[model samples]
Target chain A: MHIGRIDESATLGDSWLHQVSPISKLLAFALVLAAVVLSWNVLVIASITLVLTAVAVSARLKGRLAFSLSAYPALFALIFAFSAATSVLGGAVIVLKAVTAALGAVIVILTTPYPYVFAPLQRVVPGIVGDALLMTYRSLFLLIEKFGNLLTAARLRAGLHAGHPVRSARATTRALGGLLLYSFDLSQRSYDIMRMRGYEGRLRVTLPRSAAPLIDAALVGGALLLAATSLLWRVGWRDLNPYSWIVLAVAALGLAAAAASTWPARGRTS
Target chain B: MSHIHIPDGVLPFWLWAAGWAIALVMVGVAGRVAGRSEARRKVPLVGVVAALMIVSMSSEIVPIAYHVNLSVIGGILLGPALAVIAAFIVEAVLAMLGHGGVTVLGLNTMVIGAEMVLGWALFHAILKVIKPTRAGIGAGIATFLTLAVTTTLVVGIVWIGGGGEAAERETGALDPSTLRFENPFEEGLFEFGLFGDGHGDEDEDAEGERYLSVGRFALVVYTLGPVGWLLEALVTAGIIGYVARVRPRMVFEGALAEEMARIPGDETGGH
Candidate 1:
C-alpha cells in the first residue's frame, strides 16, 4: 500500500510542505475537496487535478507513488461513470474529480505525520476515541510488519497455492486466525502496560508549532482562490475556459521548477 | 464487497451528510454501551482489531478482485459494540489512505457495522441449533447472509443517488413489484452464430440504448458478488473454526460463555 514509504516521507522529508502546519494542510485539503464537490465542469476539475499534481511535485512528493495511489479512486470513478451513462466529457469530469480529491489527500498525507494531523482532532473527538485513533495508528506499523513476515513464511513453506483458490484461502485464513490471536494477546499486554504506566483513559499529544506562517498562509490562500474560481464556474458566473489554460500553464511551470530544484548538481559525483 | 467505492462529490450532499449524522449517533451509542468498567478492558482490543481490519482490507484476493473485510470476524471476536467502533476506525483510516471517499466514511462504517452486527446475531442464532464444534458452519452462514443483505443496501443507496433511472421510469420510484430487467445487450444471445441465429440487426435504433440501470447494476453486482461472498464466507468459517477450537474464549465470551458452560467439559465457559 506504500504506507511505509508514505510514513517515511512524511517524517523524514524536509520540504516546504513538510514544514507547514498540519491544520493548514488539512484546510487546504478541505478547500480542494469542496472545489471537487461543487463543480462538475471537466475543465475546472482537470485544472484542479493539474494544480494538485504540480503542488505535489513542488512539495517533493513521489510522483509515481501519488499516481498509483490515486489510480484506485480513478478505477471506481470509471465504474460509476460507466453506470451513469454520461458523455465522454461528463465521464472525464467524474474521473478528474476523483483523481483531484485523491491527489489532494495524498499531498496532505505524504507531508504530515498522522499523529500531528490527529492531534487537532482530539479536541473534537472523545478522549477514548482519540486515544483509540492514536493506538490504531501506532499498531498499524507493527501489524503490517508481522503480516509481511507471515506472508513470506507462508510462501517459503509452500503454504500458499495460488492456483488452488480453496487451498490458498484456507492457508490465508489460518495465518489470519493466528495473527488475530497474537493481536488479541498483544492488546492485553499493551493494556496492562498502559495501566501500569498511569494511563488515565487519554493519551497526550503535542501539536507541532507552525514555523512557516507565511508559507502556510500562502497555501491556504491559494486553495481558497482555487475553490472560489470553481464555485464561480459552477454557478455560471464566470467562464473558466481561459482561466483553465492559465492554471494549466502555471502547473507546467511549477513542475519545471520542481524538476530543476531536484536535478543533480553539475560537479558532484557522489 | 458491500462498501461503497463511490468517490468524493458523486453522491448528493444531503445523502452523505445524513449518513455522517446517523453514523455519529451510532458511534456515540456504541461508546456508551462499551464504556462500562468490564467493557473498558476491550478498548485496546478495539484498536487492535481496527488495525487488523485496515491491514486485511489493503490486501486483495486478486482472482476475485475482492478484499476480505474481516468485519464479520471482528464482530465475532469483539462483539457488536466494539465492532462498530472498530468499523468506524477502519473506514476513517481507509478514507485517509485514499481507498474510498472521505465523504463516504460514515456510509462505509454503517455498511460494515451492519455486517458485523448482523453476522454476530446470526452466528449466535445458528449456534442455538448446532454444536459448538460446528461454529465454522454457523459463521459461514452468517457471513453469507450478512453480505447479501449489505450488498442489497449498497444497491439501494446507489439507486437513491440517481443511478437507476431505467427502473424508475418503468417501475416508478423504486417500486420493486413492477421492476424488471431489460436485456442490457439488445442483440440476441446467439447473434454471433455460436448457436442459432447468425443474422442480427446492425441498426443502432434496433440495438437500443445500452446503459447500466439500477437493475442492471444489481445484475452485475449479484453476478460478481456471490463469488466474493462465498470466498469470504469460507475464509470466515475457517478462521472462526480454528479460533474456536484453539481459544474458544476469544469467540465465545460474554453471553456465549454461559451457554458454553452448559456443555460438558467445555473450555469456553468462563472468562
Candidate 2:
C-alpha cells in the first residue's frame, strides 16, 4: 500500500487470505521476517520471494504488492551496489531478503483490516498499549489529512513553491508544530468522547475467531525451510555436519506438522 | 545531527532485539516517573510527536540524503520516557514503509530516543541556568551533542557488525587517529570526510569498500555531519523559540503554567 494513501478498501476484500485471522497473519509475518534476516543465501531468498508471490496470487491481490515489498530494500541495495561496494552480489542478497521480509508483512497487512489487527492486541498485550495502538491506527488518516492541509497552507505562505530545500523544510517544521498542538486537542476530545460512552481506559474488545494454529505453524515452517535452505546449502550439502542435519530434520518435521495442521478440520471452510 | 539509515538484515538480530527490549522498558519506566498528570499528557502527545518524526524522517535533505530527525525537539517536548515510545512508533511505521528494516526497529528507537533524551535534558538544564531567551542556544548545543553521540553509536554498531577485530587489524596499517578536524573558520563550508593520513588499505574488507572503518567513519561523520548539525541546531533553536512564544507550556512541560497557577497572584499585587 502507498504511504498515506492506504485505502480502507484495500483490506476489505473477501479473498480467503482476507478472511484469515490477523493473529495468524501477524505470526506468519514475524516468522518469515525472522527467517529472511537469519539467512543470507541469494537462492534461498529467491525461493522465499517466489513463495510470497504464490501467496499473493492465491490471495487474488490485483495490485503490484510485490513491487512495494521489494522496492525499499532494492533502492538501498542499488545505492550500495553502484557505490564502491565490496560485493554487489551481497547487495543482491540483501534485496532478496528485504523483499521476502516485506512480502510477509504486506500479505498480513493487505488481508487484515487495521481494526481487526489491533482489536485482539488489547487482550494479548498489557495495559492501554493495545487501545493506544487502536486509537492511533484509527486516527492516523485524519491526522495525516490535517497535517497535509496545514503543510500546503504553510508552504504557500512561505513561498516554498520554489526549490528552496532549507526554506521548505523550515515551513514543514512550523506546520508540524501547529499540527502537533491541534492533534493534542483532537486526542483529548476523542478521549472524552470515549469516556462519555462509559469507557474507563480500555476499549471493550471482541476477540476474532482464533486462527487455526496450523496456518501459523505452516507459515513458520515454510519460513524455517527458507532459512535452512539458504544457510546450509550455500555450497551443497556434501560436507553436512550433525548439527546441520539436526536442523534439517527439525525443519522437515515443522513442515510436516504445518501441512497436517492446514488440513481442513471436519467440514471447516478455509 | 545523526540518524541511522542502515536498512534491515545489516545488523545482527540480538543487537537490534536488545535495543528494542531496552527501549520498551525505558518508555514504561519513563511513563511512571513522569507522574500521573504528565503521563496522561503523554498518552496523546506520543502519537502526534511520532507522526511528526515519521513525516520528517521520511524525506531526505537532497544530495547528502540525511533526513532531519526533529527527534531532539520531540525529546525537548515529550521528555525522555515518552520520547522512547514516540521514537519506537516512528521507527515501526517507517519500517513498514521500508525506509528502514522492521527487525532493526528497536535499535533505531534507542538511537533516536537517546537523541531526544540528551537534547531534552541538556536544554532544560541549560534553561535553569541561563535566560529563557537563550533556550535555543542550549537546544542547538544539545542537538549537536545528540548527533555526535548518535554518530558514534552508529559507527560503533557498524564496526561491530563488520567484525570489529578483523576490520581493526585491516586498518592497523594506517594511523589510529586518522581523522583531521576541518577548521570551520577557513573551510568555506563544512564537509564530512576523513583525511586518513593519505593511506589506503587493499586488505579486502568484509563490509564493502564504500563503507569506511570506524575511525574513518567517525571522521566522515563529523566532517559532513557538522554542516547539517549547524543547520539543524539553528532550526531546532528557531523551533524552540517559536514554540516558547506561542505555548510556553508546550515547550516547558506545563512547568511555567503549573507554577503560575500555583502562585495564583500573578495578575495582582504579587507581581
Candidate 3:
C-alpha cells in the first residue's frame, strides 16, 4: 500500500478489492478515465487521484505496479514543465488538464493488478484465446528488457572506433542487422516453446470469483464522490503537488528502504 | 500538424463519448477475429512497434514541421486490433506528457485507429495482388495510404467540430461573419465588451454571415492533405526500409511469412 517503489508483495492485503472480477476493474477504470478526460477542473482531478490512492493503499499493492501508478502524476508534471517553458499560449491550463486526467487514469491502473485486471476480459473473450493474449502482453515486458540488454551489449562491443562515414555506416548497419537476427531467432524459439506447451487456435483464461459487495460499492461510491467533488471545484488549484511535500518525503524514504533491501542480492541468477 | 490541440471543455461530452463508443466497437471487432487466429501471436509485438513509433516520432527530419507518427506501419506489422491498443497507449502517454491535449485523447485515438484499420486492410489486400518483390515496399505503401486517409478524417472532424453545419446553413445569407460565430466566453470583461453595446442588430448578422464558409474549410483541408500524406509516407518508408534491411526475417515471420516463402524469386527475404 506504500506510495514508494513497488514491493511486489504489497498487493497481499486482505481488502475485498483483490476479490473483484478484473472486468469490473476494467469497466471502473474506463468509465472513470472517460469522465476525467471530459473535465477541466483541477479539484476534480485531484480528488479522483486522492480517492484512488486511498483504495490502492488499502489494496496494499507492493512492487513496480504501485510505484509506476503513483509516478504518473510526476510524469505529467514533467511534461507540464516543458510545455510551460516552450509554449506561448494557454500552456498552463492545458498542462494542468493533462496532469489531472492522466493521474485519474493512473489510479485505476495502479489499484487493480494486471492479473486481476485482465480476468474480466478472459471471461468476456472466451477460452484460451484470452489467456494467450494476456500471456503475450505480459511476455513483452521480459522481451523488452532482453532487447535493451542486447542493445547495450552491442553498443559496448562495437566501441567508438569507426573513423570515416563509410566505417560509421558499416558499423551502424552491422549492429542493426545483428539485432534483427537476434530478435528473429529469439521469437522463433519462443514460438516453438509455446507450441510445445499446447498453444493452439484458442487462448484460455481462468479467473476465480473474487469481488465482494462491499468492495464493489466502495469502488463505485468512491469514484462518484470524487467526480462530484471535482466538478464543484471548477478550476482554482494550481500547485503541482496536491499532497503536502511531507508525503513525498515519506515516499522517498520508503523507496530508499525498498531499494536497499534488494541491493545485496540484486542480479544474482538463481 | 500544430498538434490540433483540443483543450478540455471545448467539445461537448457527447462528442467524446461518441468517440469512445466507436473505438470500443472497433477494438471488439478487431479483437474477436484476430485474437484466435495465427495472427494473435503477433499482437503483443504491438508494444515493440508502439515503442518504435514513439522513438520515430520524437526524432524529426528537417523541413517537416510535424513529427513522424508512422502508426500505419504499426497497424501493418501487427494488424488493427493490436495496433489500436498500441496507438491508444502511445497517444495516452503523449497526452499525459502534454505533447497533446488530454481532453482530446478520445478523438486522437479514433484518428490513429482509422490509420491502423484502413492501412492494415488495404495493405493486406495490396500485398495479395501486386506481390511486391520486396515486402518492405508493401508495408511502405500501406503506411502511406493510412496516413493520408487518417489525416483527411482528422481535418473533416475538426471542420465539423468547428461548426461546419452551422456555417452551411448561413452560406446563402448576406453576412459571412454569422457563419463563424464564436462560442460565448463563460466570463470576463472581454466577453462583456464583445457583446455589450446592446448590438442585437440583425443587419450586423448579415455581414457576419458573408465570411468563412464550410466550403472554405473543406478547401483548406483538402489542399493540405497531400503534403501531410507525403511526409508520412517518406518517413514510414525510411523506417520500414531500415527494419527490413536490418532484420528481414522478423518482418517475414508473421502471416506474411508463409506468403514470402512461397514467392518464386526471393531467398531468405533479407539478411
Candidate 4:
C-alpha cells in the first residue's frame, strides 16, 4: 500500500515463475475464473482473490503494476455499491464475480510476458490473425499517443491555452480532425509495411518440436476438464460453491508437481 | 461502458456455443465476401476501420464514467458486409485482452452486428430526409441514430435475459401471487415503499435462493447505457466529421453517390 516509487527489483530475475509457459498460467487463470463465475459464495470469491494475491506476490509484480491491475475491481466495487443502493441485491454478486475473475486474469498477466503470452494464441490461431491482433493492440495505444500529440500541436499552433467553451469546442474539434488524418496516414503506412513482409492472406508459424505436442495435449485436456466440470456443476452439484475448492485443489496439485520437479533447486535459490 | 463483462461459464452453455457458431458463420461470410471482392484493395480501408472501432470503444468520457463502443457506426461507415467481419474480429480479439467475455463472442457479435446494420440503414434514411449542408450535422445525426439503435438492442437483451431468470427463480421458490413485476428493484419500491419494507423480498431471497431480478439488472444496464452512447457519439462524430472533411468520397458507397447525383439539389449539398 506504500505510495510512490516502490521497488521492482524482485521481478528482475529469470526464475522458475518467469520460466513457466504462458499457456500454463493462462489455463490456471481460466480455471479460477470459471470457478468464481459458477459460484455465488463470497467466501470462494475472497479465497480465490487471496490465492491470486499469493500468486501475484510469487510472480514478483509490485508497485505500479500491482496497483493498476488490482484497482479495477475496487473501481467496480464502487459502482456496485451505487447500483446496490438504487437496485436489487444482484449488484453485489456482479461485483464479486467481476473482482474474482479479474484477479485470476491479473495473476496470469503479472506472471507472464506480453509477447510470450500472445505467442501461444498466435500458434493456435494463424499468423495473419496474430498480426491482426498485434495491430489492434498496438493501434489502441498508438491512438492515445497520437491524440495527445495532436492536442499539443494544436495548442502550440493556435496559441489557445484556454478560452470560452464554444472556442474550446472548435479547437478540440480541429485537433480531433488532425488526429484523424494522422491516424489514417499511419494506418496506410502500416498496411504497406505488412504488404512488404510477404504476408499473403495468412500468417504461418511452425511450433518447436520439443514440448509442443505435450503442451497441445495439456491444453485440450484442460479445456475438456473445464467444460465437463461446468456441466457437472449445472447438474445439481449445488453447494456454497464447490467449484472453487476443486480449482484450489487442482492448483495445489499443479504447484506440488512443479515444486517436486524442482525440489533440489528450491533451497539453493532461496 | 457497454463492454460485455460476463466471463466464460457464467452464461449458459447454449449461449456460449451459439456465440461461437455465429462467429464461425460470420467468418465464412467474410471470407466469401473477401473472395468475391478485391479484399487486398480494401485491406488498408479495413485496417483503418478496425483502428477506428478500437479507438472509439476505448475512449472513456469523464464525469459520466462510461466508455464508448460504436459497432453500429462502423456498420454505417463500413457497410454491413465489412462491418460484420470487423465486429466479429474486434470482439474475439478484445475477449482475449479481457475487455469482453470469450464465451459471449457470438452474443457480442450479434449485438454489435445488429447495431451496425440497423445504424447504417437508419443513417442513410435520415440523410435522405434531412439533406444537411454541413458534414458535422450529418455525421452527428448519423451517429445519434446509430447509438439510439444500439442502446435499444442492449436494453432489449438485458430485459429478456433478466426477466427469464427472475421468472424462473420465482416459480421455483416464491408464491405465484408475489411475483408481480419483471424487475425486482421496482418490485422492491412497491413492496417496501422506500426499500425498508420489513418483509422486503430481497432479504428473504438473499440466501442461496437469491438472484438478480430483471428490474434491478435493468437499472444498472440502463444507467450505463446512455453514458456508452454519448461517448460513442462524440468519438464517432469527431472521426466521421474528420473523414467527411478530408475524404468525403470514402464514406458514401458508389451506389449511394450515383443515386444522390440523380436527385435534385444534390450538387448543392455535395462537397
Candidate 5:
C-alpha cells in the first residue's frame, strides 16, 4: 500500500511543505479543491495541475511515486471522460481534474503525519468515530504486516498452490479467517492497553505547539490566488488568459528546475 | 467495488451535497444507536474492521480489475450500527489516499454502508432456512445480492449526476441520454474501443459527438459487474464459512444469539 511510503515521506522529509502546519495544509487543500470543482476550463485545471506538480517537486517528493499513486484516479476518470463523449480536449480536462485533485491530496498526506492530519478532524466528528478513525489508521500498518506474514507462511507451507486456483483460494480464505480472529484478539488487547493507560472514551490528540505562520500564510495565500483565478475565469474575466499561459510556463519551468536540483550528483569512480 | 469513482469535480454539486447531507443523517442515527450499546468496547473492533476493509479495498485483483470490498464481512462482524461508522472511516481514508474524491466521501460511505447493512440482514434472513453448516452459501448469496443492489445504486447516482448542463457546456456533449453508435454492425463489435478514440468518432462535430449516455455506462458496468460480484461472493463465503466453523460465536454474536441459543448443544449457541 502507498500508506507506508507516504508515512515515510511525511515523517522523514525536511522540505518547506513538511514544515508547514497540517491544519494549514488542509485548509489549502480545501481551497484548491474548491477551485478544481468550480472551474471547467482545460487551461485552468491544467494550470492548477502544473502548479501542484511544481509544489510537489519543490518539496523534493518523488514525482514517479506521486504520479503512480494518482494514476488510479486517472484510469477511472478516463472511463467517465469517454462516457461523457466530449471533445478530446474535454476528455483530457476530465482526466487532468482527477490527477490534479489526487496530486493535491497526495501532497498534503505525504507531508503530514497521520495523527496530525486526523487531529483536526476529531473536533468535527463524534468522539467514538474520531477515535475509531485514529485507531484504524494506527492499526492498518500492524494488520498489513500481519497479513504479509500470513501470506508468506501460506506460501512456505504450500498452502497456496499457484497451479491450483481452487485450493489456493480456499487456503487464502482460511488464512483471512484466521487473520480476522487475530485482529479481534489484537483489538481486545489494544482496548485493555488503552484502559490501563487511562484512555477514556475519547482520545486526546494535542497538536504540536510549534508554529510556522509565514509558511502557512503563503500556502493559504497561494490557494486563495488559485481559487480566485478559477472563479475569475468562470466569470468572463478573459484578461488573465495571457497570464494563465505565463503561469503554466513558469510552473513547468520551476518543476523542471526543482527536479534537476534534486537529481543525484555524479561521483568520479577511480 | 460498488463505489462511484467519478473524481472530485466531475459530479454535480447538488447531487454530492445531498449525498453528504443524507450520509451525515445516517451516520448520526447509527452513532446514536451504537452509543446506547457497548460502544466503548466495540470501538476497537470497529477500528480493526475498518482497517481490514481498507486493506482489502486497496488491494486489487489485477486480471479482473476488481477490489475485494469485504463490506459484507465487515457488516457481519461489526453489526449494522457500527458498520456504518466503519464505512465512513474507510471512505475518508480512501479519499486521502486518492482512491476516490474527498468530496464524495459521504456518497461512497452510503453505498458501502448499504452493502454492509443489506448483506448482514440477508445473511441472517437466509440462515432461517438453511443450517449453520451452510453459512457459506448464505454469505455468498447475500454478497451477490447486496452487490447487485449497491452496483445499481452507483449507476443511479451516475445517471442523476451525469445530466449536468455544466458538463454539456464544457464538453459540448448533451446531457447523458441513451447509448448509440453510428454503425454498430458495419464497424464490428470488436472494433469498438472502450478507451480509444472516444467511440471511434474522432471527426464527429460537437453537435454530432457520440453520447455514451448512462445506458451505455450501465451496459458496460453490468457486463463487468457480475464477474466481480461472483468472485467477491465466493471469497466472502469461504471466509465466513471458515470463521463460523472455528468461532461460531463471532458469526452468531448479536442478532442470532437468541436463535442459536435455542438450539441446545449447537456450537453456534456460544456455550
Candidate 6:
C-alpha cells in the first residue's frame, strides 16, 4: 500500500534540509550506499537503515519516507517465502541493505527538487548531454501526468468493474499509442521553442542561493560517522564480533538525529 | 520479453558495477552517433516510452508473479540505441521509486537493453523482407528472440552469482524441504505450473538444494518463459501492425526505408 513521489513537497516546505545544497545530500547518500554494500553485518545494516529513516524524518518526509522502507522488505519477504531455509538469513540481510541504501537516497531526493539535483551534473557534463539530461528530467513529470490521466480515462471507459483481460490490455495499448504520438508532437513543439529562443544545446541552471555549509556539513558528517563507526566495529571480526558496541552507538546517533529534526528552529514551528 | 523482477542487494557489487559500466558505454555510443535534433527528439520520446514501461512493469499480473516489461514495444519505437538508453533511464528511476534495487540497475538495464536491441534488429530485418503490413510476424519472431536472450541472461547471472565454495558460506546450508511453506501451485495456474502428480523438481533434481540452484532455476524459467513470450509477441505484433497501417514511418520503413521508394514508390523518407 506504499505510494508517494520521490520529490513530494520538496520545494514547497521551508525545512532546513530543503535549504541544504543538493550536492551535499548526494555525497552523504553516496557514502551511505557504500556502507550498505560493503558492510555485511545485520545489526550494523539495520542500524544504518534506522539512522537514515530518522534522518528522513528530520528532513520532514515522515510517513512517506517510512512507507518506502517497508516496501522493500515486503517485496523481499515473498522471495524468502520460496527460498530454502538456509538462504532466508542471506535474503533478510539483502533486504535490510536495500532498504537502507534506498532510504538514504530518498532522503536526498525528498529534500531537493530536480533543478538543484541536476545543476551539478549540468555543469559537469558536456553541453549536449547535459541539456538532454535536463530535458529528460523536465519531461518526466509531464509524461507521468499524461500517463495518469490516460489510465483514469481507460478505467472509466471500461466501467472500472468488468472488462475482459484482453479488452483491458487492448485499452492500455491504445492509450500508450496515444501517449507516444502526444510525446512526439510535444518534442517537436519543444524543439521549435528551443530554436525560437536562439538556443544551442546549452541550458542554464541557477545555483543554490541559501548555502548552509555548516548544517549541510553536519548532515554529511553524521552519516559518515555512523558508517565509520560501523566499519570500526566490524574490524577483528574473525576472532569475535562486537555487535553491542555498534548497536549502542547507532541508537544514540539515530535518536539525536530524530530529536534534531523535530527541534524547533528559527523560522520554523513544530 | 523477460523482465528481472528480483530486487537489489542480491547480486554482488562487482556484477552490478559491471552491468552499469557496460550500460554507460552503450549510452555513450548512442549519444555519439545521434544528431542534435535526433537526440532532442529522443528525449521526449524516451521520457514518454519510459513512463509507459514503468506503468506496465509496476502493475502486477499476480497469478504468475509476472509483469509486462514492454521492452519490445520500446525497441520497436525507439530502435536499438535509444531504446537501450531509455530502458536504463526507466530502470534507474524505478530503482529510485523503490520498485527495483539501485544496485542492480546496471544488470536490469543490460537485460532489458539486450531485449530491446535484439528485438529492434529483428523487427526491422523481418519487416524489410516480409510484407511491411505483416509486421506482426516480425514482431512475433523478435519477441521470441528477445525473451530467449533475456531469460538466458537472468539464469546465467544467477548461476554465476551462486558459484564457488563460498556460496554455502554466503547463505546458510539448511535442508529446504524441512522448512516448507504452503504450495500455491497445487492445482496449477491455468494448467501451467510445477504441481500435478508427484513429478516435480524433487523427483528430477539430484542436488536437492534448499533454495533455487542453477538447475531448478533453469527449469522454472523454461517452464514459465514461453507464456510471457507468447503474450508479449501477440501484443507487440498487434501494436506494430496497427502503427504501420496508420503511420508507416514510425516503425514500418526503419531498416527497409530505402526499399520503400523502390518497391511501392512511397515517398516518406526515413528520418
Model 5 lDDT tens row, B1-271? 5577778877767778878888888887887788775566667878989998888887776555578888999998878888898899898888888888888888998999999999999999999999999998999999999999998999888777665444344323221233221221111111232112234543333343332367767877788789999989999999888888877877867422422234433322332
Best prediction by DockQ: 5
Which residue runs of candidate 5 sit more than 4 Å off their true CA positions? A83-87, A237-244, A260-270, B164-212, B254-271
Off by over 4 Å in 6: A1-5, A69-77, A80-86, A119-129, A206-210, A239-249, A252-270, B1-8, B63-65, B165-227, B254-271
Q: Name the regions of candidate 1 deviating beyond 4 angstroms.
A: A237-246, A264-270, B62-64, B163-213, B254-271
lDDT of 2 by residue, A1-270 (tens): 254334443455765666556767766676667556644444445556666666665555644644554565555444433331234455566556666676666666667766565565345433444455556654567667787788778766874656788788678667766765565565555544665676665566564764465665665676566655644442222232112444444545544554455445423753
Model 6 sits at an interface RMSD, in angstroms, of 10.4
C-alpha local distance difference test of each model: 0.73, 0.58, 0.48, 0.52, 0.76, 0.61
In model 4, which runs have C-alpha deviations exceeding 4 angstroms?
Answer: A1-18, A73-90, A109-131, A155-170, A206-270, B5-13, B41-44, B70-73, B165-210, B219-224, B227-231, B254-271
lDDT of 2 by residue, B12-77 (tens): 555677776886676566545543453443454566566666666655665554667788888887
Ranking by DockQ: 5, 1, 4, 6, 2, 3
Instruction: State the local distance difference test value for candidate 5.
Output: 0.76
lDDT for position B186 in model 2: 15
Q: Which sequence of candidate numbers ranks them by TM-score, best first?
A: 5, 1, 6, 2, 4, 3
Of the two candidates 4 and 6, the one with more favorable TM-score, higher being better, is 6
- Please provide, for model 6 over B183-253, each residue's C-alpha lDDT reduced to its tens digit, 9 standing for 90 to 100: 21111210122112323344232232333356655676677678877877776776666666656776754
Better of 5 and 6 by TM-score: 5
The local lDDT score (0 to 100) that residue B82 gets in candidate 6 is 69
Runs of candidate 3 with Cα error greater than 4 angstroms are: A1-31, A34-38, A46-93, A122-133, A157-190, A200-216, A230-270, B1-11, B31-70, B78-109, B117-149, B162-185, B188-239, B242-271
Q: How much is the TM-score of the A chain of model 6? A: 0.83
lDDT of 5 at B31: 77
List chain B TM-scores, each candidate: 0.75, 0.72, 0.69, 0.69, 0.78, 0.74
TM-scores of the candidates are 0.85, 0.74, 0.58, 0.70, 0.86, 0.79
